[model samples]
Target: MPELLIDIPSTFVERIERLAAEENESLEDMAMLLLRRGYDFAVTRPEVEPDRSQRPGARSDARLDWWREARFGLFIHWGLYSVPAGVWKGRDWPGIAEWLMYRAEIPVQEYEKLAAQFNPVKFDAKAWVSLAKRAGQKYLVITSKHHDGFCLFDSAVTDYDMVDATPFKRDVLKELAEACAAQGIKLGFYYSQTQDWHHPDGDGNDWDFDPAEKDFAGYIEDYVKPHVRELLTNYGPIGIIWFDTPKGISEEQSRSLLALCNELQPDCLVCGRLGNALGDYATAGDNRIPEEVLDLDWETPATINDSWSYKINDHNWKSSVDLIRKLVDIVSKGGNYLLNVGPTGEGVIPQPNVERLEAMGRWLEVNGEAVYGTQPGPIQGRADLRTTSKEGVIYLHVFDWPADGQIRVEGVAAQGARLLAGGAALPVEVSSGALVISVPEEAPDEAATVIALR
Candidate 1:
């Protein structure tokens, strides 16, 4: 026996081992055979490779105009982990629900059993999209697949999907796609490309799979590429492909995935986590906002509560005021806000989550112009305040309340000033080389108030 190490999931080695055992051959011979077989599964390849010989992670910059303006979106993390809801074997798990498999180190045999009881009768795709629309989210990005290796959509590459393995046979992705289209919302898919825990050839689950079983090339050819193709072809007009937690993939492999996406859908936006920093835009640290402005295109994936996925013990919900301020801060710093909501196993967005979203939507109803289609404020590094400008007009976001009726804006000479929520003009004057506006006795909005200046 020879040691065969690979960069792919541990399970891929098991697959090659099984192949070797079935043929009564050595591991080295099986490795070669696996690579040969992988080289041949070119079904996902386009008949004619487009003339897109651009560098790895290359993308069409002009195609993301809509994405640039879509300052807010909803990120949903739903899968079998919701079934466990963070409780495994009657013991409470602390982290996010989606990481149940990896964190708990549960074997694939035992973890797959979760599908038997997975039923989301309350899951309504239409309602989900409708809520997003009302919440002022320009798009919706849901977890098509998470690290647990469970597929929420119907994947031909594997039968361990919502339509096949789970009791709920409905395809969640299909309904979401249809609903998003009907509601005029852009839809994107979040996939855990390198961290699938379910498929025998998928990555992660080192406890169940040996080192030799991890075949990066084999998994890429047999599973990853095909899954991307299925999502691209089966779903109509995907806005973006969000690949997360890049660990096992190489730079060349990452580039190949990017090229494949560019080939299939030239205009599709790819997130930076696809590995090797090869993506259309940048992804920020989880649930965090950048204090200073970023020169490159970036986005912050935030949570309505503390956890990205459903957690029964996690009640640290961000207030409507807090979320509004956070969104303003992100957009002010030249970044998009990707807020998350984790539905329960029963398929319902927590009531608290819905209420907070609706509140933000209500605020947007009055102050959308201040957010949408705006650029970074002329002034930078204002913690208590932010500015977004379009054309000659600038909107000042007052995150804190002034106990007095007077407010001052530095580094700006205001030609005029008015309340954004209402069309009321406020007296403005430049004093001490700063723009000052006269506000009311109290803050107009509990979250933040926007003032327009010309």
Candidate 2:
């Protein structure tokens, strides 16, 4: 957990290459082995314990408190790939922005050319955090590094990062951290574990692979871990280290990484993608929310559109009402919803994405009371409806309102009821062991109607 900058010896790289050939292992495997040894050594080596000031709370217990309370967050997937803005050469790329190179099978050198022109002149950290705050997002998770292997932050470990390589030389992560601090939004970093095909050690394919020439494991030790240390130490109190791609990581290595985070900032949260349960919360990928999330902490990440990164031709963005419904649905099921927004290459979130968020913000302005501080219901209701509770009051969110001004809800024996939208006293009576209430002639909102019960 030392904040010292990593300095790898030139001979170390040669040794790694030699070791890989001797073991008949791929460079990636050798890199993992070296990293495992380095991390193990770092953790076990004795050093003077620094001042305990600003240290985080117990990892196991502190995170649960935050997890249960944070019902909604904003997931941002912006990077150099956004600069391509979903276009390769002169034609439009069909896949996501991050995958523009891979999907198009563009040569690494060709994709690297985009980096020279990558400049987010309109990038405004304050504006970005303000949007998330207005949308009622309690936390913000930005992609610090994606599968493309480009680092968003300024890492001394490599020149292939945002600060040194791209035209936009500012530390995006640093500015974001400052903005989140100013706005009181918890900040988290999403780090992809897999290296990109563009890097030197990452050039091999599944077929006709050779391990002698490339030292993949050395890259992990010399590049990845050191960069992670820099991130944890430099970024003032990152709330979470959201790791991705545990494909090559071993349980021991994962545990060591988690331990490093805990040692550096004990309160920092980690996600389930870190190989073992080393992560504090379980993550459900895009649009794949669980019907019954486990009793433990969990979150579901989904995009407003089909892709995580902005796609010009991708017109499948979810409406504000749909996004709000999804948020309510997830919260009612005891989970946090991390809705994603992909900004264009010039550092502007598309007009459609901004419009949807604004609309959702308006709805939240009125209905946030039932969401912000509420806990999940004791019993999940029917498919068309959901429930959340605050104090002794239960709020039933009816997704599909019944016609004929009558709605029947089971399992809740309520003594009194009221309409949350209008605050009008509702007449509730029990019949045949079910609670029946009179619905308004028309729905308060086209999306869903919330009824408060005590």
Candidate 3:
């Protein structure tokens, strides 16, 4: 199917204006609300079939299968803010790098000045992809464009891009895209849909619900659309469009943006933050993991520390064990876990983040079978423990060890059982009620032991 150019019809605009007047909301706010609804409609309607020609190497089923199997991914929050590298002047900034301008209340002009000094001399895209792979991550989502409004790629749409405006003068997105393709890691772009503080039209003071901005619709047509086109077309194959901040967009605008993305990159997955259901997957905000699988494909994105971008004084980092457990829990609940890493100003990932990822990787080396290529178990019970299955093989991830060497697994119909990490076969005896298995005196893994059922 060809790309459908989304132009808000005049009648729909009139209805929205009337609704806004009735609700005492600005026209922009009403439009945004409507767009949100439309997005939900698009996501839920299922009227639009996926374009098969655009999705390369796999059918829709295969892509969905691969996505379901890939329960873990690495999210990098790096950009011009990385040049500040978590510090303002000689003082350590405790906030995320991306929000440095907002936290410091530095005007956009002053923040753009950092572009002159934003040269990532040691920035290696291959190394970044390699790190993610080593961490046992199947996909990589980087900020192609953040709320700060700087484009990582050479955008024909704007002069305020990495290759054109910054000292780095490199197309980071192109490099990363190539690296991801080479490494067989799915590449995703994090594009902020609404707040582009740098762009004149993106000025939050006007368009956001707080203050009315003039000609907001014009901004979307001229600036946002062109940049999005650049992202979808210039990049070889973007796996996902991770949109954020749908503040002032109309429902029609949101639908148009999503439709355009699908038209350009038909197989590409879109996130829930597009202010509507125009996305393939739902996104749970920072550090939020839903207790139940959201009845839709979803991913929980969380930072190692409080900040998405590197912060000099933010020593708070999640332990390797905790991170691994989070991954296991998320997968067992049938969701993807996206762990974030904020790189320092000099373009190097902080040592702490690297160490944590490496430690998780070490654990993954042994118990990864329980993780990758597995689906959620049928039985959702078992406190502190979860199960995943593949090829009729059930993996019981024991979060809490039993005092005696026995753990009761209800509804396990498998005839044989073994330890995945240790490879030690266990005696499985079925009682009148449930199947009981004798675990080893010591657990195979300190965090979680995988009991493989055959």
Candidate 4:
């Protein structure tokens, strides 16, 4: 499509921007909305939804039911950047290892050399999917391509991919898709649509490609769209197409990518970072959980440790207890938790990550009913206690057990109560117009104990 240039008043542009922010939409969407309203007024007819049911591979809202019920997932960040492991020329970068190429300001040619060394010989698709299943993760989203423009899957669009660029020469995404299917876990892919440092026409390579002379449209049509098509066509029923860092992408481009995903696989979801607020689900900021419950579908993507990719010096890891609590907190607020694991260049998930995930798996083995397929509880903003509900039964997740052997909750009357983990009954009484449940002094589980109320 050819670009349409129009001149609008500066005041109108500002107003459009404000409206977009208020509605959580893009400025272009707002402008188009205004145009649509004007046209409706002139036509004297009510607005109608586009008839998409007849379209090829038409999308259905039913596809998202599984995602809504799935409270936990795994995120993998692996690419050429893992080869350097945040150390470029003997200097340890202090931030995310995935952004090493841009942070170090390495030339495109120099960064391309990393692809030759990007041999993940130990990468095991079945083992990775098995870990997610054991951790009680319902889905897995891997980085098909990162901002560094390195691809983990085979891409006919470019030879700058794992299959053709490295010694391992394997399509990890293909193997992962197969493994996930066999394990009954949903699969997703993370592709950096706008930012491709190696491609001159793509965004975010100012060190080499002059932005003024770049043909971003060419990058989108010739490269981005093709890559996306191949992913949706090759991968069997992808759970999500996770795009990141919209950068300078236009609303039209965002919609085009979203439409393509819909056309290829109607069930596959598009994340919020696709830009223009066109995603099927909203994505929270990195490592951030909402302070209050959200009415819409949303998710929080977080790292097990500080860096998303492997960094030899970054030993700081979140404890299993903390991770469990975080998962409970997110679920209580009607959101999904996508925890990340950064594998080494040798294709090994760090031992620390493995231990933490195993611990989480053990915790979920006992209390998974409280986390999975549950809705947000009526209670809100309680630090010590969070709640999840399913089939009219409420489950209280106690992070900090009371020492007095009594836990009181207002505005709720429990006919009966029992420990979800152990199925042991507890005494419940109505006192001061509140339901007080008597329990043991010591918590049944340190990482958020679940008590079911009937």
lDDT of each: 0.84, 0.77, 0.77, 0.88
Compared with the true structure, model 3 gives a TM-score of 0.83
User: Could you tell me every candidate's TM-score relative to the true structure?
Assistant: 0.86, 0.83, 0.83, 0.87
Per-residue C-alpha lDDT of model 3 across residues 1-454, encoded as one tens digit per residue: 4654445535556768889999999987787788799899655643112210112222234546667778889998887787775677776655566777655555677778877877878888899898998999999999988888888889888777888988789998899999999999999889887877677667453222223545567778888888888888887988888888666567688778878988998877777677644456666656766566445566788898788877767888888878888898888877888899987657788889999998888888888888888878765756768888888888888888888988887777878899878688999898877789988788777788888888
Per-residue lDDT for 319-401 in model 1, tens only?
A: 99999999998898778899999999999999999999999999999989989978888877866688888888889898877
lDDT of 2 at 266: 86
Candidate 2: clashing pairs of residues? 27-216, 27-217, 28-216, 30-217, 31-217, 31-218, 32-217
Pairs with backbone N, CA or C atoms under 3 Å apart (clashes), candidate 4: none
Better by lDDT, candidate 4 or 3: 4
lDDT of 4 at 283: 77
Model 4, span 1-454: residue lDDT tens: 6877766545457768989999999988888899899998656521111111112231245667899889999999999999999999998876899988887778988999888898888999999999999999999999999998988889989999999999899999999999999999999999999998889998987777788999999999999999999999998889999998887888898889988999999889888788766777777777877788876677889999999999988999999999999999999998899999999999999999999998999999999999899989988898899999999899999999999999999888779999987799999999999999999989999999899999
Off by over 4 Å in 4: 1-60
RMSD of each: 10.2, 11.2, 9.5, 10.4
Error of 3 at 257 (Å): 1.3
Candidate 4 CA-lDDT value: 0.88
lDDT of 2: 0.77
Number of the top-ranking candidate, with lDDT as the measure: 4
Q: For model 2, how does the per-residue alpha-carbon lDDT over 1-454 read when each residue is reduced to its tens digit?
A: 4454444334456667889999999866797798899999766532211111011332346556765677888899987788777887787866677777666656666666777887889989999999998888889999988877788899887788889999889999999999999999999999875545566665322212244666666766676678778889998988888787566666676777777778888888877777555567766655665566345456778889888988778899888889889988888877788889998778898888888888878777777878876778755847878889988988888888788777777788888888778788878888887898887888898777788889
